[model samples]
Target: MNKILIIVFFLSAQLVYAQENLNFGRQKEIISPQTNTDGTFTFRLKAPNAKKVEIQGDFLIAKGTGPAVEQMKLGADSIWAFTSQVLPSELYSYSFIVDGLKIRDPNNVYLIRDVSSVVNVFLAGAGKADLYMVNDVPHGTVAKRWYESAGLKVNRRLTVYTPPGYESSKANYPVLYLLHGVGGDEEAWMQLGRASQILDNLIASGKAKPMIVVMTNGHTSNTAAPGESSKGLYKPIMMTPDVFNGDMETYFKEIIAFTEKNYRVGRNKADRAIAGLSMGGFHSLWISANYPNTFGYVGLFSPAVLPPSNAASPIYKDLDLKLEAQKKNGFKLYWIAIGKTDFLYKNVSDYRKKLDAMNFKYEYRESEGGHTWSNWRDYLSAFAPMLFK
Candidate 1:
C-alpha cells in the first residue's frame, strides 16, 4: 500500500511539472549580466551554441528625436559589449535573454517596484529629472490595491490616481491608460511627468475634461534599468527586449481587467484610449494597433520603432485582432507626434511609412523641440482637447 501511495505522488508531481512546462513552451529565458567598469560591461553568457542575441533600451530614445544610437560589439572572450556617448543619470532599465527566456540584470544597484515586479538599473541623473515622478501635490489620492490573477495564481498590486472631482461626481469618465518608458514605474506619469497637475490645471480652467488618469507600472519583469553601477557604460547588457518582456501587452491584459472592476470607465473600446512616451510610445503603438476594437483613441509621443517588418512589436502575428475596419472607420483618432530633433524622429517616420504602406489613416505631426518634458507637456495639452469628443 505504501509503494502504491508513493507511485501516485510521483505521478501527480510529474503532471504538475508538465502543465507548467507546457505554458512556458520551449522558449529560452533571458538573464541580466553584471557591470564591469564605468564605461564598459560584458555579457558573460555561453550562448555560443544559440542562434542570435541583441541589446536595446530607452537611453537611446530619450537623447534626441531623430534615431536612437543602438551600439553592440562582441568581445574575443565570447561576451557581448556595448557603449554610448552620453548616457544620462536617470533610472533607465534594460534586460538580456539567454536562448529564449527573459531575465533581469545581475549587477543593478537601483531598483523600483514595477507593480508586482522589481526592476534593476543604475541611476545616472538622480533627482534632476523627477518631473516624471509624483510629488506632494495639494489635492489627490494615490491608491495602491491588489488584483487577483486566477490563472497565474497570484494577487498583484496596482497604483491608481483619482482627480479632485473623482469623489464628488458619480459620472463615468473617459479613461486614458498612460504607460511609462523603460526603467520607469507606473508612478512615472503621476510623479515626474506631473500628469495630475497638468490635468488639474486643464480641468480647472475648463480647457480639459475632468477624468481619471490611470498610471500603472509598465515593466513586466525583474529586468534592471540602464547603468548597473558607476562603472557606467561597461554594463550595457540591459538593452534587450528579452528583459523588458513584451511590456504592457501583459500588463494591459491585467490592468484593463483591474480598471474595469474598480473605476467608472466606459465599458467598450470607443471610450477607452491609450498613449505613452518613448518606450511607452513603442508599447502604445503596438497595443493600440493590435487591439483596435479595444481602443478608440491612440496617441504616440516620441516613439521608437524597431524597423522593417519588426514594426512596433507584440509582433503582428501575435496581435490576432483584425483592424482593417478600425483603420478605416472604428478609430475616433489615431494621433502621433514627435520632436524634429529627437533621435526617435526617424523611427516615427519609419512608423508613418509603415502605416502608409498598410493604407491606414493617421494624424502624424512634427514639433520643434528635442526629447524633453516641454515637448511632452505641449503634446499632452494639445492631445487632451481631441479626446472623447
Candidate 2:
C-alpha cells in the first residue's frame, strides 16, 4: 500500500515538473507583429522589468539618422506595444530596443541574416512583397554548387536556382549570372533578396520566362561564404583581399564555363544575362564590357562606377576603349537602376553622363529608397521580366 502511494506521488510530482518547465502556454499568449486588417502592424513585447522600450525597423523612415526608432507604449499588463501606420506591401525587418540594447522580437520566428547582423522580419500588405512570400505556385530548386577555379587556385562554391519543370522537361533554358555585393556570399540573394521566391512567383505569373540563375560569390579571397569553407566559423568582413583589384572580373570566366558545361542552358549570347547589386554591379559592368557579346543582357543595380584608384591591372586598362568596343558590339539590353537617395547615386549619375557623352544606348530606372535589400529585390523583379524577350 505504501509503495503504491509513493509511486503515485512521484508520478504526480514528475507531471507537475514537466508542466512547469516545458509549458509554453504563457509565452504563446503574446502575439507580436499582428498584421491588422487595415495594413498596419502592431508590435508587442512582453518586458515586465524594462523601463523603456522602442521599436526600430525599415518600415519607418531613417531620414539619414540611422534606423528610425519609435517609442512603444507600456500598458498595465507590462507589455510594450506600438502600432505603425499603414505600410506598403514589402518584407520589413525590425528589432526591439529594451532600455537601450537592440534585440529581435521574441514572438517572431521569421528572421534573415544580412552579413553579420540578424533581425526579425514580417510582411506588410499584399502587393510587391507577394514575390518574397512562398506562395502555392510551382517552386524552383536551389542548390549549392562547387566549381574548380584555376585562376583563383581553389574550388569555389556558388548557388544555383533551376526553374520549375526544369527537372522534368528537356528544354534548354536561358541563364542569368547573378552576383552579390562585397560582404554577401552565394547565399545572400536567396536569403535577403529572396531571389528564388521572386523567380518562382514571376515565372508562375508569366511575367518572366523560365531560366536558370547562377549566384556566384564575388569575394574571391575566400573560396566560399563564411563558415562554408576552410575558414571555420569566422566572422564575415566587408572587405576582401582580392576585391576591387579586377581579379573577380578577370576570373569570372571559370564561373560561366562551369555553369555552361554542367547545366542544361543555352550557350548563345542572347540566352545569357549578367546582373548584380553594388560591387557585383561593378563586376557585371566590367565583365560584359571585357568579354563583349558573351552576355546579351547586362544589368547594373546601383553599381560602384568609379574605377579602382590604382588601375595597374591589365584587366582595368583601356576601360574607355573597352566601353567603346562593347557599345559597337550589338547587345539586347544594358539596364541600370539606382535609388534616388543611394550613396552611389552620384557615382551612377556620373557614369550615366559618361555614357551620354559616348552616346551609348541604355535604360535607366530610379527608385525611392537607398542601398537596401528591398530595392535590390524589386530591381530583380523588374529586370528579369525584360530578359530574353
Candidate 3:
C-alpha cells in the first residue's frame, strides 16, 4: 500500500511539473517597445485580421487638446510596427488602438494603473529618468502596514519606506509624509510615482539624506485601498467622500503618532516633512497650516487650492488666521510648484497672491507640462533633495 501511494504521488508531481513546463513553452517570442541603438523605440503588434492599427503615447507631443496619435504600418507578416523619433530619456506610457479599441501590449509584461486606467510603460535610460530605475545601489525596504486610527475609528493601511542601513544602524531618521491625490491610496506613491526607486537612488548618491517615507491614503471613507480592506474587489472611483472636507487633515496627527511609535523616526517638527500632488497638495497646505508646529517642510505640486464653498468643516475655517499663526511659529521650507498649462494654474496663482499679501515666504518653481504624473515625479526628485538638509 505504501509503494502504491508513493507511485501515485510521483505521478501527480510529474503531472504538475509537465503543466508548468507546458505553460512556459506557450509564451510567445514577440517583443514590444524595443529600444534601438539610436535612442528610438519600435513597437510591434500581431494582429493579422485587423485592418488598421494606431499608437497613442506620451512620447509624441499632443497636436491640439487630445493625445498624440500615430499610424502604424502593417507588414507582410501580419504585424503592425511604428518607430518613434530620437526621444529623450524618460519613462513613457503607451497603448495600441487596434481597430478603434485601445488595449495594452500583449508582449509587454510591465504596466501601471492610474486611477482606473491601466497602460503599458517603458523606460529610456541615460538621463533624468535614471532616478526612476532600479540601480545597483543600497536600496530601501518598502512595507505595507496597518495602524489603528483613533480619530477615524478604524484600522488603516499605509506604505512605509525605510532607508538603507536603517535596520543595522541605531539612529532614528527624519520622516517625510508623502500623500497621494484623489482616487489614490497608500500604494500609489510607490507603484505609480516610483517613490521607492527615487528615494533609493537619491539616498545612495548622497544627494538626499536618509529618511523614512510614509505614504497614506487620503480618502477618509475607505479603510484602505480598493481590494485591500473590508471593501472587496470593487471598481475604484476618482471621487470619494470627505476628501476636501478636511477630515483627513484633522485626523493626520494619528498617522504621525503611529509612525513615531512604530518606526525609528524623529518626533519633532524639524525632522518632519509633508508633500503631495494635486489634491494631496491641498491636504499638505491645510495639514501644515492648521497644525502649524507639526511639519517643518511643506511641498505642494500642482495643488488644487481654495476650499469648496459648500465645505462647512471647522478645519476649513480661519484660513488667514491659520496661515498667520503658521508663519509666526516659523518653519523650515515652504515650496510650491506648478506646470504652466495646468488646469489649476489660476487657482494656484490666486493662492500665491494670498501668500504674497501676507508676506508669507515660499519658493516657487514652474515647469512645462500640465497636471501629470511625469511632472509630479520630477517634482518629487527635486523636492526630496532639499529635505532634511
Candidate 4:
C-alpha cells in the first residue's frame, strides 16, 4: 500500500510540474458544471496577472452572483485565483472581466458564439469535462442543403430539422423558422443548442406539436454573421449591427420559397411561424412586423430591440416596425418571452408597454432565469406548443 501511495503521489506531482511548466496559455484547461451537494458549482480561474477579475456570463452576471473576486488569491508567479458556487445542471456562458474589459476565460474549454463574431464560454452538468457532442440520443434529422441565392449570386446553406415521420407521413407539416443570435449560423442551432434532440424529446413526450424547424445561416454576407458580439455573456454591448432587411430578409424569403416547394409543408402563411433568440429574436420581430403577410405566428425570445446603439439593431431611418397598420392582418399568435433578469428586460418591457399602448395584443411570458440556453430551451419547449394552434 505504501508503495502504491508513493507512486500515486509521484505521478500527481509530476503532472502538476508539467502543468506549471507549460503555463496557462496554450494548454487545455478542463472545467465542468461541478455541482455540489447544495446544488451549486464553483467556477475556478487560475490567472497569473489579473489584478482584479470576475466571472461574468449570461446566467449569473448580476452583481455578486459570479465568480469569487474578493476571495481571489495571488499565488506564486502572480497567479490570481478565485472560485464561486453556481447553480448546477444547467449551461452557463461566462467570461472573466479583467479590470473592466471582458475577456475569455483562460481555462474554459466550452465556447459557442451567440452573434456575428463574438463568443462566450459555456459549462454544463457539473463534474469532469464532457466530451464535445458525446451525449447521444435519437435526435431529429438535421440537413444542410445548398441553394443558389438569386440576390447574392452565391450558394448558401440552410439547415433544416425534421422530426420523426417527416419522411413517412404523407401529410404536410407546419414550418417554424428558427434564427440564431449574432456570431452564430444555421449550424449553431444544431451544434450548440442541440435543438433537434430537444424537439425530438418534446415530440416523443407529446409535449410539443411536431413541426419542421428551419434554421438558415443567418449570415447573408460578410457583414452579417452568426456571431455579432465581441464580449460574450454580457449584454451585446460591443458589436456592429447587421441590418435585418439586407441578406437576412432575402435569405428568409428564398429559403421559404425553396422549402415549401421541395418539402411537404403548408403553403399558407397561417401555417408558418417565425421566432428566434437574442439577435435572431430581433430578426423575427422586425421581419414578421414588416411583412405581416409572411407569417401567422411570431415569437421574440429575449429579443434585443432598443436604439441602434443597443448593438442588436442596425442603422435605419424612420421605418415603422410597429405593425398596428397591419394588426388586423398580423400574426395569429405573437408570443414575447424575456428573462426578468435579462439585460434587455427593461427594453422589452418598454416595447411591450408601447405595444399595449398601441393596442397591439400579444402574449408576454417572464421567466426567472437570465439569457442562457437552459432558459432558451425552456422557452422553445413552452413556445412551440402554441404555434399554428
Clashes of each: 54, 0, 0, 23
Question: Which candidate leads the pack in TM-score?
Answer: 2
Order the candidates by lDDT, highest first: 3, 2, 4, 1
Ranking by TM-score: 2, 3, 4, 1
The root-mean-square deviation over C-alpha atoms between each candidate and the true structure, in angstroms, is: 17.5, 2.3, 5.8, 8.3
TM-score for predicted model 4 compared with the true structure = 0.67
Stretches > 4 Å off in candidate 3: 1-28
Worst 10 residues of 2 by lDDT: 20-29
Model 1: per-residue lDDT, tens digit, 16-104?
99988986663323223443346333333434554545444445554565434343455554545455445543445555554555455
lDDT of 3 by residue, 333-389 (tens): 999999999999999999999999999999999999899889999999999999988
TM-score of each: 0.57, 0.93, 0.92, 0.67
| Cα-based lDDT at residue 67, candidate 3 | 87
- Report model 2's TM-score to 2 decimal places: 0.93
lDDT for each of the candidates? 0.61, 0.91, 0.92, 0.68
- Better candidate by lDDT, 2 or 3: 3
Report the C-alpha lDDT of model 4 over 316-365, residue by residue, as the tens digit. 22335447654768668889998878998988988888888778989989
Better of 1 and 3 by lDDT: 3
Error of 2 at 56 (Å): 1.3
